[model samples]
Target chain A: MTVPTGQCCAPIAREPLAEDTAAELAVMLKAVADPVRLRLLSMIGSHAGGEACVCDLTDAFDLTAPTISHHLKVLRTAGLIDGERRGTWVYYRIIPEAVNKLGALFAPLTEPSPGPVPQPVAGRSELGLLPA
Target chain B: MTVPTGQCCAPIAREPLAEDTAAELAVMLKAVADPVRLRLLSMIGSHAGGEACVCDLTDAFDLTAPTISHHLKVLRTAGLIDGERRGTWVYYRIIPEAVNKLGALFAPLTEPSPGPVPQPVAGRSELGLLPA
Candidate 1:
């Protein structure tokens, strides 16, 4: 798998997002804009192997299996996670690029190494250093 | 202003999110789940001096001023932004702690300074460096 650099590391706050890009990203964001899906994505992304069996996930919630599947399906459809069938179980794991895109879109930028520190927001000039 | 640390820097992927936390974050996510709101946020965040006037934001969209105001209200209500009225227009700016929480929810962990690099996900062990 090819790793996308630069494009997936820049924060969305660095500039105004274009219309098409915002629309595309909105779909991705909408997919995680739910409590169940957010927890599923978090669980799958942080599981011991960086992946989780559907069986492991079902035990964590009071909701029915179909409901969990539905949420997982939404996450898969959003490109945030992928599932693979392995014999008796389907294992789910995060799609790093997709997750990275979410990170890139909002991650506070790392401190700039070469240039002067970013200017504080107009009215917030009282802050001596803008947290990157 | 009091600064919130630790709580906002830990990524959601660090562990399974608690249900209440998931529900709370989902509300925040819903606010930016739209194409227009995302763009509005980006524009305000990256704008000169880190804030934008309602007039500036209104001109960027083809929708009526009230529509733009509605979207801004969602972001503000979600605690992602704060606005102030100075005579003619209400100037809006990102709430850094809020934005940082969004960033923290997904930002790839920064390079580890003391501990060993995180183990590559179970199947993706082929990757030598997990890019932060």
Candidate 2:
């Protein structure tokens, strides 16, 4: 799949995010906002083969089967997880792009090559270093 | 500032996320889940010197001062942004630890020496590669 890089998706924390970029990021973030979904993602991310079957997922949570299905649907809709039906069971896996994109949103940018150093600007005067 | 590292904050997607790690990440994600807050973060992230003044922020959006303050409070409480009053204006900047932690959460994990290669497991052959 194709992923577009935006200011928020940039590797460094110095840059500001664009309006559209924040909105896009928010959409993905919203998907993980729920407690059930967060637990679901944790289970899926920790699942063998980096994926899990719906049958396996249902047993882990105390929620109803339909509730689990609904949460899965939200995750699938948000692009955080992907699902496929095979025989009697449906399997779900974490979408790397979605996860990576979320992860990349927090990457610390480097100046040249050394790596991003997290410099906490206490107050003012450091604004000059940010991008224009 | 001090930052916590875990399987999720490991800079690669291979390792499974701990339940606590997912919860922590979810807390931060929820902070950015709002439309107004997303805009605020974008403005803060994009601001010169990596911060924005409250006065400047108030004029940019159509929301009331109280509403803006509420959003800022949410961001502050979530650790996405930090603010301090300086006489007349309150300046808010993106917390580097918070942003970097999020970014690190998505960082591409390097295997051995080269780098992480996104391996798309079609079925179940790749289950062995995951952590126990």
Top candidate on TM-score is 1
Give the poorly placed runs of model 1, Cα more than 4 Å off. Answer: A1-9, A110-132, B1-9, B110-132
Tens digits of lDDT, candidate 2, B20-80: 5666777877887877787788678767877789988888778899999999998888877
- What residue pairs clash in candidate 2, if any at all? A12-A109, A16-B45, A16-B46, A103-B106, A106-B103, A107-B103, A127-B49
Alpha-carbon local distance difference test for all models: 0.74, 0.65
Assess candidate 1 and give its lDDT.
0.74
Clashes of 2: 7
* lDDT, residue A67, model 2: 93
Give lDDT tens digits, candidate 1, residues A5-69.
23532466666787877887888899999989998998898788889999999998999999999
List the lowest-lDDT window of 10 residues for candidate 1 chain B.
Answer: B120-129
TM-scores for candidates 1 onward, in order: 0.78, 0.73
Docking verdict class for candidate 2: acceptable
